[model samples]
Target: MKVIAFGASTSSSSINKALATYTANLIEGADVQVLDIANYNVPMFSEDTEKEIGQAEGAQAFLRDLSEADAFVISFAEHNGHYPAAYKNLFDWATRIDRSVFGEKPAVYLATSPGPGGAQTVLGAAVGSAPYFGGNVKASVSVPSFYENFDLDTGKVKNEEIASQLKEAVSALN
Candidate 1:
């Protein structure tokens, strides 16, 4: 299976990206592609912006990536307890192009942050929104206290409890 993974953030050193990549690697023999939101620079969505930009090329590229994937792993980053603006903008644009941007693809929704709450609010938003976009959310996970539990340099979840939970959740993707 071809798995496409992404972190819903524009940060150059995004922990969500690192965590998502790590999780994607767990799926045995799957060809995984990791995407960076910064690579898709769709402008903020407004009716006027859409009218001016005509749905954006970046959004089409994002949709193309999803269309190529058999499954997905998305790690959301919380900004004000909500989805980050960059990802939201791209999703909005891609939805306008096609409501089923995810095309009923099996997906694992994940979230992580430095805080104990992880990025649960945004992950909740993803779980709720995925259905509308035809994304099959097989599992949803929140990795709390990312810094204390994940090591950026090694790209591993350091906490045993969290690691075990991740194994179960990610293993379900197989």
Candidate 2:
């Protein structure tokens, strides 16, 4: 199976990205592609911009990449209890190209932060809205106190409980 994974953030040092990559790799025998949204630098989405530029090359490329995936692993980064602007912008533009942006692909949604909230607010939003955008959610996990639960140097989850939960969640994809 081919899995596409990404953190919905543009931070250079995104812990969410690391988590997404680690989680996606848990799928046995699956080819994982990790994407960086920052690389697809499309202008912010707006009706005016859409009218002026039509579909953006960046959005087109993003969609093309997603079209190849059999499943997805996405870690959302919360900005004021919502998606980060850069990710939302890319998603908005992609939606303009295709409203059903996820293309009915199964997805494992995840979220994490250094604090205990685990970015769950945004993760909940993503899960709640996923179906309308063609996402088939397999499972969702929220890892809180990221530094305490995960080992960045090794790119692994140190907390056994969270690791087990993540393993269980990934298993749903199969």
Best by lDDT: 2
The TM-scores of all predictions, comma-separated, are 0.96, 0.99
Query: Please, what are the lDDT tens digits per residue for candidate 1 over residues 1-174?
Result: 999998989999999999899988888899999999899877778999888879799999999888999999989999999988888888889999999998988888899999989988888888998888998999989999999999888899898888787777777777
- lDDT string for model 2 (21-46, tens) is 99999999999999999999899899
Task: Give RMSD (Å) of candidate 2 vs. truth.
Answer: 0.6
Off by over 4 Å in 2: none
Against the reference, the lDDT scores of all candidates come to: 0.89, 0.95
**Where does candidate 1 stray beyond 4 Å?**
none
Least lDDT summed over 10 consecutive residues: which range in candidate 2? 37-46
